[model samples]
Target: MGRWGPDARGRLEAAALELYTERGYEQTTVAEIAGRAGLTERTFFRHFADKREVLFGGSTRLQDLVVGAVERAPDTPAPLEAVVRGLEEAGAFFQQNVGRLRRRQAVIDANAELQARELSKFAALASALRGALLRRGVADPAAGLTAEAGIVVFKTAFERWLGETGQRDWSSLLRESLDDLKAVVAGDEAQADPP
Candidate 1:
């Protein structure tokens, strides 16, 4: 065995995504990922627990980024604004990784298990966001709803970004999605039945 290099993890991730896309997630193996990356299987284990982790591994870091942002947000911002601030912070995770994300989404969408994991990750993030809001003095229901709303906005923005061809900032997409959510909510008041 040779000394592990700094790029081993990144190489493994790239190789894993490539293999997962080319061979189908279920067909890809850890050894294949390691071989494609020019690393050993041991190196792959050092970076990820299994093939699936290669796709969903970043969830923890992303959740931390968003939660930290929410905790640090100023008191002046409204609950939704604070949540958006958190999402904007988390958006940085996908800033220049749009293509990679698109590939990942495709792989996840093609697999039922991966799709379930994706949803679980989103649920975990929403729960974390709710906890962060609660820590910031937001009461129940409001904190929970605000957190869920932020996740909705983030997911919608991410989908829109994934479909785009021209290069665009991820944060900008998030902001636009947030605006769209606001508009939809505001327009809901007009649905009242005639008296």
Candidate 2:
């Protein structure tokens, strides 16, 4: 790829991931990433604020997707149901990017700072979901509670999905995780048995 490639951001992200995987994230530098991508340091800065941003650049886009799903959800569903709708949308997104996400998760798992940032990202997503639910006429505690619960479901489902061998789809895993949550909340005896 040329320095002025059409997918400068994609190239930068790929390059950064490659370097971060090959050499530790802390050991990689912006100039090396730019060189690997056939981009200049200036081009890298234009696409991302710093090396850390490479991992987090898509967070805003993901947040927007979830919030938009929640906003467009039908009014008949309960707050948690509406939150599930948003999570399902996010599941679709994750399904399409499983490979990249797995690699990103590996990178994050290897670094304490990245793990902290990942938690912050989830917190931000929860806050965004709460705001969307509130805008959809949900009450304060319900909106907050539902949003937090949805994030928990999402995180649990996502971890399970990552650990699986791709036999199941993202939506199914999400629904199953949600079902498990509901079972636990309702004190279902069946949940006591190992699955």
All-Cα superposition RMSD per candidate: 3.3, 2.3
Q: Give the alpha carbon lDDT tens digit for every residue of 1-195 in model 1.
A: 342878787788899999888989999999999999998898789889889988877788899888999999999898989998888875656866878888989999999999999999999999999999999999999999999999999999889988988577777888999988988888853556878
**C-alpha TM-score for every candidate:** 0.89, 0.92
The collision pairs in model 2 are: none
How does residue 68 of candidate 2 score in lDDT?
96
**lDDT score, candidate 1:** 0.88
The residue-by-residue lDDT of candidate 2 on 96-118, one tens digit each, is 78888888889999999999998
Best by lDDT: 2
lDDT, residue 183, model 1: 81
Q: How many Å off is the CA of 112 in candidate 2? A: 0.7
For all candidates in order, the CA lDDT equals 0.88, 0.90
- For residue 158, model 2's alpha carbon misses the true position, in angstroms, by 0.6
